[model samples]
Target: MAVIRQLDSLAPDFDAQLELLLAWESVADHRVEETVAEILREVRAHGDVAVISYTNQFDRRQLQAAGDFMVSASELQAARERVAPEARRALEAAAERVRAYHDHQKQESWQYREADGTVLGQQITPMERVGIYVPGGKASYPSSVLMNAIPAKVAGVEEVVMVVPAPDNQISDLVLAAAAIAGVDRVFTIGGAQAVAALAYGTEAVPRVDKIVGPGNIFVASAKRAVFGQVAIDMIAGPSEILVICDGETDPDWIAMDLLSQAEHDEQAQSILVSPDQEFLDAVERALEKLLAELPRREIAAVSLKERGALVAVDSIESAIAISNRIAPEHLELSVANPEKYLPLIRNAGAIFLGRHTAEALGDYCAGPNHVLPTSGTARFSSPLGVYDFQKRSSIIYCSPEGAKTLGRVAGILARGEGLEAHARSAEYRVRNK
Candidate 1:
């Protein structure tokens, strides 16, 4: 039932559909902004009182003080006991895989010495503190906690604080267990724009952090956007999306199932398949029909597929890659023969899955790379969440008299070219005095 369009059917008007694909990118009404802004101001003004009140009103958890917000070690242990043995083992496996992948992302400080006695270096240091927002409701994501916190741990961040919404003052044992596994320093039962505000502007219970990282809903996104100056935040993530590039050789059933995997995330999700062969196109359409009836989330995935999904018949695999680059999808699958051959052509996409056996779902759970990625076309400029996100880099420079004389002359010349007299003098002072 998804929109099936032949290349010939795409008139200039069809470009409009491509644009509509960005509907989730629409910023909510200023009313939401004004409302969130007011909530932030309240948290800023009243500290813990406003946070507690809003938590009660929104999350329905009446907290008398900041201490009530924290999840204790006992609760975490209980969560481990409550979780199924299989689930716990699976989570442990996922954590191990994630840590192994991010270990490769850890940065090291390096210095380079010049012949003129100048030493230039870069020092990579972790943030002293960071806050992670994990969604509540149907959005309980223990996988996300592992994705966000393990990197901070790997980066040697001193403190990792987590804020999650819990409607009944009951936080998931599973999420708490994941936090424990990732070595989170604290867990707060608070969420929404108010939780973000609490993280940005320290409450009596929540300490202001240097950065915030994790996935959230629209309100959480807007709050992060609002608090950017006060605290660092990961990218304002767009909606979930997946693009599968298949050849006639791959099974249409696999293609259909893979496409639905992302579409089931939400009604606003996007799924698209690109292929050069029409026979494969027809087969995929038939497979989608057969599979769509069997899926438990058929209604949601069906609407998402029909509204935002696509089956594009490109002229060749090269054209498919060109089209995919333009889309800059969050997940790109090369479900073709020898996917490695085209890896060089893919300059965009948040993550790439090489070969038909490597499904995007592998990346979501047990695969090593983080699932938290830039969505929409932001992948064209951004990247997946990594240890680098948890750390900051500073330039290290040391110059002796000889080095100063050699470097300052060029610095003075550049400063003078920009008409920055003060800057020129600052550089020239070293050379002149030396």
Candidate 2:
């Protein structure tokens, strides 16, 4: 049985225990940092040679040239055809829904004219190129391809370059199919920090991308951190998390399975349940013990539950919401009757799954929302990956002569007050002499 922690709001040390539970240090290992720094430097200095050499050594592939890393268009098409009819249909359906949802998030350039004919507003444009790193081999995620690439396409990104490690030249057909469905412009069989470096600093083979986005192992995460300013990254995501706020009305078995879904993501993933019903919490715990034995990933889920999972018994549903807001989980499920009534009370959460039937797993795949969420309590300030992330906004201010003269005086005053003489003079030049 998983030794998941049980907490009560009435306990004297509950606050301290909660704090400890939520604490997760995202600090990269010093050795990993040093190694990433060396790899980045070599890639920057040597270009394609360094990337190709590292890719061959790390992925155990025997590629003669950097060009060999590129996965051809014909290959993608073959992979799409290789998929079973039912799976292909599911992928197509999911891609369509994801595309439809993100289309709404696409920002268009807008401007408003002032009385003096000054146009002021914002202009939105997608990045010229973007790189998406899809984890391959046993960790292949076709859903990730759809979630990351579809949004970039929806945002009108000119090129979407994808990199997936083909260890021993083995690549997942599902991933390739997903890429095809999502309209990825390019694919490279490169992984680790080298792939990141190649994307950040353009190599002879891999074109430089304006931004890099996707999830990977520790090395990929460190490399992303090292090359942040050189190129934009989606987010340095932490482990997956799910916090289910149930009012004891939802099925105990359903709640237990929902918690396990996140727990099975990895040993570090967290799964927590907050509810007012102590008896329901007990029922869920029993369900976890019984159902966990049946899961293929039981060991992983067990470790996660034993180490990071919790069942918090709160005084009321309002108390549960307050705790959830403080935790700011990556995914939140309101498995309660009248879930909509509690929506207003939720201030922070990467994604909110309302009602008893809406499982967090749906949001991960076909629920129409992007599942790439802000983890490690970052939902307090950050958001899920969307079209907005792939787009850039520029402030537009085309001041008319009359408007400039009127606004320049105000700007000059503020600049002078701040002791910026050059700024004051620049503004003064636009002001009327009177």
Candidate 3:
């Protein structure tokens, strides 16, 4: 039977056990780094031809030219019409919800004037173009297309370029339709480190983007890391995570399934449950064993739970929340009677699901929040993807004649105190004989 690691706060070495369970270190694989470096170099040197060659070799495709895989407007339209009515409706609905939620996150430029008419504020500007990568190796992620692209569009990004791997020259229609709905300006059938390189440095076919945002395998992550200074990138996400704090009232079945949701993502993903009731933890474990047999991806989830998942018995609900904050989980679920009572105590999390009915999976799909989130323990400092990621802020300062005279004197004194006469004179010149 599949079993998740169990812990009790009353144990002598509980803290140590928890520490061991939560420990996640990503050591760089030298081979992966070298491979990505070579791909980047080739893409930079050969441009479109390089991208074409890499795609053919990696994705098992036979392509003649760079334009062979460029998705045209007609193809996008065809995809929109080709999808089943039910699937198309869900895509449209999810896209609309994502767009609506991000619309509220849009920032505007603002300024304020002082008595002397010295104005100061900020200007919000969208990036000219952005690239969003969608992983198409194991499964199709139309939702990813919406989550990454809509925010940029809502932030007023002019052009959105998307790249997805089409292994065997087959891509998903739903993904294409999603691109249409999310306002993606361009779509290309390419992925992996080469796709990242193409986006980072302009190729003959792929235009260089100001920023690249999305998730992918290790090759993509390493590529993004290698090209950090060349272009901005979203966070390097780790394995998916979910921490559930229950009061022992929720159905054991539900809690088990919630934990499995993260587990099914991969072997590294973690699903944790914390509650004061030891019997509840037992019940969840049994439920997990039962559910594991029924899942299509049972083997994957089984390994993930056996190795990475956990069930902890806390002293009380308060203690459970304390442990949660310390973990800084990516997804936190308060599956208790009154979930709001603990909101003030939650200082760290990428997203919070309140009450028993709010499944973390809902947030992953149509919950209207960006599913792209800080992973591992990054929730302690980072945040969920939003419109802000696609936008840039610039400080605005305008000094009036009188304001300059008053400020220049202070600036001149400060500059000279630092022993830079050139800087001091520049400031003093502004307020000279005022």
Best by lDDT: 3
Decreasing lDDT order of the candidates: 3, 2, 1
Candidate 1 on 1-434: residue-level lDDT in tens?
24333342234665576666546645565878998999999999998899999989988777888888888877777787789899888889999999999999999999999987789999999999999998876456899999999999999999999999988866677898888888888888889999999999998889999999998877888899999999999988877899999987888899889999998898888898888898898898888888988999989988888878888777789988988998899999999999999999999999999998989999998899999988888899999999999889999999978999888899999999999999988988989897
Q: Please say which candidate is ahead in lDDT: 2 or 3.
A: 3
lDDT of 3 by residue, 129-184 (tens): 99999998659899999999999999999999999999998899999999998889
By TM-score, is 2 or 3 better? 3
lDDT to native, each model: 0.87, 0.93, 0.93
Error of 3 at 211 (Å): 0.8
Candidate 3, pairs of clashing residues:
none
- On TM-score, the candidate that comes out on top is 3
The stretch of ten residues in a row with the least summed lDDT in candidate 3 is 21-30
